[model samples]
Target: MPTLSQQLLAKEAKYGASNYKPLDVMLCRGEGVWVWDLDGKRYLDCLSAYSAVNQGHCHPRILAALTEQASRLTLTSRAFHNDQLGLFYEELCTLTRSTRALPMNSGAEAVETALKVARKWAYQVKGVPADQAEIIVCDGNFHGRTLSVVSFSTDEPSRHGFGPFTSGFRIIPYGDADALEAAITRNTAAFLVEPIQGEAGVIIPPAGYLARARALCTEHDVLLILDEIQTGLGRTGALLAEEHEGIEADLTLIGKALSGGFYPVSAVLSHDAAMGVLKPGEHGSTFGGNPLACAVSRMALKVLVEEGMIENSARMGRRLQDGLAAIQTGVVREVRGRGLMIAIELDPAAGGARRFCEHLRDQGILCKETHTNTLRVTPPLVIDTDTVDWALDRFSRVLSAA
Candidate 1:
């Protein structure tokens, strides 16, 4: 007889859309840094649901807050006030050091909100002519897959057949400050970018690139929108990746880990001047900032900060990166990342990264590949010294064997 996982896999293939090409492991449960398959095999969780579960899966505190608030109240929309919303706003703003916030339900929605804010600010505040505003983006950025976001994308897969696309976006090479300056025009509204291109094989830009970009944005009066959905909330060892260069963005986007992987909660954290463009009825979401989301996100931030997950990320990230680099193997082309957002790039001659990932799965570890040749290792922030060392041993074994 076919196993339960096989049965479920067949069922999904028959019924579900083929949007994602996930690994052939059907997971049943997760806690802390580990997950179990339907066949009762266990493995470390290295992806963290693209950093949404940075606080780890099924955290007790976040779970408690979720259930308690779920029992009391769930949604009231923007028309009514909830008891948890104000507190959530205060805490998040204080932690992120943002003056204002526009709550949403996903990283994509937050990106959309920032785009709208930037365009509105351009016309209303910067004296740009109507419908002439343009936003500059990096070449290999993966902000989100929404139609408007994909319009600026240079990746063919994300853009093919998704258009006739949105307009008013200009493409510039990633990490090129000179290109950014040359691309800016009188109607340029904002410069949207990722500090480290997470989806493009964990690609980090040249040092001082972000600081230069920040200064240019200020000098040109262009709002800097830093999308931290994949890199923020301790994924890169910093509270926000912008802190790495000691720079601030006019609009900051964060999501994924905001609700500890328990709920779909995201927000646009904004500078006071840029956010002032939005009025009472200009924009909104039905489930954004609802009581349940607020409650879960509040606890998520608390445990992440109070429990020292950020510090752990910094220390553990260094240890893991060093260990991966120490592994002597002809297959490894490079090992690079900030914090726990690691990537092991394989030599093209050594086949693709997918086989290494499959080998990892069999060895009781779980990680995924990006851009064909790079495997990303982004375990939950709650991972410890022992776990990092343990994962390193298996990773070394797999790469060395190849």
Candidate 2:
């Protein structure tokens, strides 16, 4: 008979869509920055569910809020007001320093909501003609998996066979303010970009790229939308990655850690000029701002600020980056990232990143490969220096062997 892991894999392959190529190991439980497989093998988590578990897995505070709220109330559609929504709004708006917020269920939904708000603002506020407003996006951006979001992606895999794609989006090379300025016109509405491009192999843009983008957007009268879903809420040391550059975006999209992975809670936050155009009955989600999500998110935000997790993330990230840089392995071509969002790009001529990832998994460190040959390391914010050193030990061995 097959073991539980094998059985689960077989069942999934037989019953579900084969859309993912996950690592062979199966995680049964998680805490902080560690996970245990079904066979009882423990590993340090380096990916943190694509930065969703920044507060750590199953955090006691977030869990407490989730359980308490689950017992009290869960869903109450937007038709009537829920007691928790106002508190949620206050906490998120205050934390992010935004004038208004529109809650949604996923990062993709939040991105979509931002797009709609920008379009509406372009028409009503910016005095752009209807259906003529254009949004500029970068080449190596990964906003979300939604149809509209994917349409602007430069990756062939993401765009192939998924079109006829959505229109009104102009693509430009990232880190080039000139491209962005050239792409903008009288009908330009917004420029959407990811701070670090997590899915694109933790690609950090040139220094001052964001400041230039912000300046260009302001000059062009275009909204600057920063997709911080994968890099927000202390993942990159600061509360949001945008803080690293000391620039503010016209619109911000946050999710993943907003609920500490307890539930799907995402929000589109913007200044009054951008968000005010959204009126009642224009958009909503059945479970977007429910009592349960609101209560849990409120607690999650509290823990993130009060616990000093962002400071910890910064310290640990520096230690991890320094340690990885010390590894003089021939296989490593480059080591780059900001805060906990790090990446090790292997020599392309050597092979795919999966081999190294598999070896790391066997040595009790769990991480994921991205963009063919880049190994992404994004552990939970709660991870300490000792845990990071332990994972680095295993990583050192694996990279040395490779």
Candidate 3:
């Protein structure tokens, strides 16, 4: 007979969709920056559910907020107001320094919502011809997996068999400010891009790239939409990755960690002119601003700040990155990132990142590979110096051996 883990794996292969190629470990519980498998073996979760658990797994305060508000009120839809909606709106806007916010359940919904908002803002505010507004996007962007989102995707695997593509989107080279300048037109309503290309192997742009992009967008009278779904809420050590360049996005889409992994919550933070274009009947989500989501998100944002997680991310990030840089350099091609979001591009002679990830998993460090040769290491923002040191040791050993 197969072992329990093997049996469970077989069951999943039989019943589940083959969409996700997750590692073989079967997680049963999580807390702080750690998780336990079915056999009670613990592993430090370096993935953090694609940076969705930045506050750490199952935080007590967020859990309390979730359960309490869940008992009181979960969904009121948009037909009537729930008590938590206004408070959620105020606190989110204040933290993000945005004029208005439109809530949605997931990052994709927010991306879709922002796209709609930009098109409408173009037609109404920018006076672009109806249905003719074009949005410029980067080549390697990973905003979401929606039909329209995949329309402009450069990843062939994601776009395979998923089109009849959406029009009105122009793809430009990432980190090339000149490309952005050349792509702009009066019909270009917005420049939708990620501050740092997270899913493209933690690919950060050249120095001053984003600042120049921001200036170009402003000069061209275009809205700058920063998809911060993977980079916001202290994942990049700052409150938002755009802070690294000292620029503000006209519309910032955030999700993932908005609820500390307790619930799905996302929003589009927009300027007054952009968000003002959305009238009542124009757009809505049934569970977008529900009371439970609002309450949990409020506390999630609270603990992330009050607990000094953002500060910790910056400090630990420097230590971790420096340590990784000091590792055995033969097998490593490059080590680059900001804050807790990091990646290691392995040299081709060392085989592939998948084997290194499997090796690290055996050492009780649960990391994931973003590409065939790139290992993405993003731990929870709540990670401490000691934990960073521990993770660095495992990474050094695994990559050195490779």
Candidate 4:
């Protein structure tokens, strides 16, 4: 008889939608920054599930929390209060230094929650008339796969045919504070932005752009909402990426590494005036604050703060950036990143990014391509210097040939 893994693979091939063009490998187990495929091959994970596993996969602390909570109780539907939800809120609020939190199940949901909160605050607090509240977004931003999120996306594939979309969003060129100011209006309720555009090939705004954006939002009485789902929780060497700019947003969306990939856990965190607008039953999810996910997220937060992972991310991220920059390859156009979220934008005429990614996979480095020609290299924060050097050597070899 074929093994269970083989049977599962067959089933997936036969029934699943081919929406994802993943690397031709099936992983069965992961630890720290490495994953083992079904055939006993090991690969250094460079994507980290788009920074969702910055704490690394199956982290012992989070795994124990999940197991312990699963043994006790998994779900209570948010119809009744759970001990872990309050604890999760306390831990996250303490870590983020925010006053209120609205838990959700995914990054998109958290972003949607923030949008709703911002619009409500606009009408209820800022006195913008109903349906006139507009949100400003950036050109190369990626929030999530929700309708409202795609409504502001400048990416054609993410927006095409996904609408007739939601309204009340305006787009401006990223890093251009002048464009931001031009886009703002009295009816502008919020400025929704990703501090560093992650899926837009790890594009970092020009220095002082975030600070200027914060000033503009405050100046215009608009809420500054940062979608930090891909950049938060030490992925960019900070609990929140905005901290690097010494600016604070009125609302922040976080997910991904919030639960260390154990489960889908996201939250909309904000100050009292912004989040206070969310009255009871205005927004919620059945599994948003479930005990199991909350317990796991609590442990994940502890590991991020206490285990010195953020420092490691900063250190290793520099090593990675320097090493990739040092690679003498003509195909490499530029290396840009903050913390562990790095990207290598190749010359666009060099064929697509997928071929290079497939080559890296063959070299036992599991990385992925993004946009059209940028290769995003985000590994787990637990990676050590030796493994990084090894990965660099392999990357250098691959790019040299390309």
lDDT tens per residue, model 3, 144-226: 89999999999999999987999999999999999999999999999999988999999999999999999998998899999
Question: Candidate 1's C-alpha lDDT?
Answer: 0.95
Off by over 4 Å in 3: none
User: Residue by residue across 1-402, what tens digits does model 2's lDDT show?
Assistant: 998889999999999997799998888899888899988889898888888888999999899989988998899898889999999999899999989888999999999999998899999998999899999999989988889988999888888898888999999998888888888999999999999899999999899999999999898899999999998999889999999899999999999999998889999989988888877888989999999999989998999999999999899999999899899799899999888999999999768898888898889988899889999999999998788888888889998887
Task: For each candidate, give its TM-score against the true structure.
Answer: 0.99, 0.99, 0.98, 0.97
For candidate 2, the per-residue lDDT at 251 reads 93
Tens digits of per-residue lDDT for model 4 on 1-402?
997678887889899997677777889999999999888989999999988999998899999999999999999987899889898888889888999998899999999998889899999999998899998888988888888888888889888898799989888898899999999989999999999999889999999999999999898899999999999999888878999999889999999999999999999989999988877788889999999999999999999889999999999999999999999988989999999999999998889899998899999999889887999999998989999999999999899998
Position 266, candidate 4: lDDT = 94
- Candidate RMSDs in Å, in order, are 0.7, 0.8, 1.0, 1.5
The C-alpha local distance difference test score for the whole of candidate 4 amounts to 0.91
The predicted structure with the larger TM-score, 1 or 3, is: 1
The backbone clash count of each candidate, in order, is 0, 0, 0, 1
